[model samples]
Target chain A: MLNIIWPVFIIISFMYAIVTGRVNEVNNGIFEAVSDAVELSITFLGTICLWNGIMEIVKKTTLIQKLTKLLNPLVKVLFPDLKHSQKAKEEISMNMVANLLGLGNAATPLGLKAMKTMQEENCKKDTLSNAMAMFIVLNTASLQLIPTNVIAIRTSLNSANPTQIILPVWGATIIAAVVGVLATKLITKKIK
Target chain B: MVNYISAAAIPFIILGIIIYGLIEKNKVYDSFLEGAKEGIEIVFKMFPTLVGIFLAVGALRSSGVIELIVKIVEPMTKMLSIPSEIMPLALLRPISGSASMAVAVDIMKNYGVDTFVGLITSTIMGSTETTFYTIAIYTSAVGIKKTRGILVAALLADFAGMIASVIIWRIMSTSFC
Candidate 1:
């Protein structure tokens, strides 16, 4: 998907910039984006390490088993094909927990770990597996109880009630997750 | 009250995990160090992909292309009662996290955060993920080249979330007023 999307973005941007004589802005945009990426990575490094370190402890202890047990039923329902790969299932459960808590930073590392584990079970190395496709959709259609970032942004702007949108957000989030999962299941089934 | 709990949640989780490690007689410090090291490796692996995505998104935003597209789509969205002010955010929400965030902030600033437009923008931001960024990082980490049906499904989900946000806010704003 990114294969086509990435080039199309670049082509459109350049074409529009040239026609509008905004070539200099495009140059600055590229450079600014590179620096922003680096800055984001640097900021991400700390939280990633903190959570991954914490998760490592979770893994060594029986905490993973307990946590996995809590989420096992949901995991089984979502990715039944993953039953044979307990490791993948455990990682996915952890990722789901992080996401549910609205911990975006923590979720990414756990999610990447899950993806890596699922990749091991892929028969065709380069192609995305059914489980992998479902997992991506789940992450993209994130379902969280509270939207910390949006709330924080609102508070910073001195809103009368920062978290007023939380109820509406929950409604939208659940709808997104349901649609995303159903779409993935239906499409992948058709392909097979 | 909500803010306090959200802030305390992480610390409590960390403390719980460590205590569990101690009770289980696990090497908590060593394990954390090992995991932290792996975390660094993961970030390094993701940097190249991040750069590519950021570059494309940056160019798209800076070129005024998104704004142009939003203008073009404004009529169709209006027919559905979707505010044209949020069209840029609805479009960018799936593409880039920071870009959508900036747009959301812009909306909040232009229209008071307590207004209908601001409420809808906040809801959309909360519900939808940065689909392109999430997909690129997850797929590239495991070296999966063919993304197949993931993009379509993810984007469809994002669209649903955005529309849902608009509808819910419209209903709320009307009833409350």
Candidate 2:
């Protein structure tokens, strides 16, 4: 999907620029994009490293176990099929916790682990099961308590109140999660 | 008051993790270094993806596609009380995080960082995931060929988040003011 969409963006942009006589602007934009990516990545590195370090320390403790226990019931409700799979439960819990803390980079491995674990239980290895669909929806729309990346960008931009969007982000993500879960449930039932 | 508390929360979380690591008798500093090293690697890994997406997004914006989109969607946005300036960010957000981040930064640079458009763009960025990217990586990780309803559900969630960001920002801005 992205493979097609990405190239289309470039082509359309070139076409539009030529027609609009903004070819010079497009050339400049393309040239500037490389540095923009480098700068953004570097800016993200310090914060990513800091939070990831803290997460690593947290991982060495029994915090994950406690979090797993705390989130067990909700996980059970969301991933009912995984109720019997201890490994799946742990991976899912860890993924959710990382996501909620806005540790997206950390969450990817855990999410993949959860997906692989769920795949092991699926009768059809190639096709997505209902459980996998639910997991994807939840992971994609994961409710974040702190939008650390956004806050970091705001701070870097010298915004007076970098964390001011915290409440709005929390509210918005909660809505997304709810809507995502509900849609998953509805769609899965209809398909079955 | 809430801002102060939320701002303090990051430090509190760091302290909590360190104290927990101490009680657990873990080698906190070593583990931190290991994780930090992994963090650096992750940043490097994202470089190519970021560059590709940014180039595309940059072209799209500079070539007048964004303005074209804004013109087309301006009425609907105004009806919903969302500023048209943020329309491109909302559109590109689900597709690419780096692209959307660049747009958000552009918005902040043009409009004041404290402006409603800037705040809402930041909120939207925070609230939504990169849906297509997440779907692609996740489905491929498990070798799932058929995604079924995942795409629809994820896109719906992204839409809901976008709307919610605008609504929440509008309600909260009054309090902040």
* Standalone chain B TM-score for every prediction: 0.61, 0.80
Off by over 4 Å in 2: A1-42, A124-126, B46-65
| Model 1 C-alpha lDDT per residue in residues A148-180, reported as the tens digit of each score | 667656766668787677778889999999999
TM-score of model 2 (CA atoms): 0.85
Would you give me the overall lDDT of model 1?
A: 0.81
RMSD of each: 6.7, 3.0
Which number leads on DockQ? 2
* Candidate 2 per-residue lDDT over residues A1-192, each given as its tens digit: 558878998999999999989999999999888788788778778876776677778666777567767888898888887767989988989999878766676789999999999999999888888888998888778568777667767776678887788878889999999999999989988774
Poorest 10 consecutive residues of model 2 chain B by lDDT? B97-106
Model 1 residue pairs with clashes? none
In order of appearance, the predictions have TM-scores of 0.68, 0.85
* DockQ by candidate, in order: 0.47, 0.62
Docking class of 1: acceptable
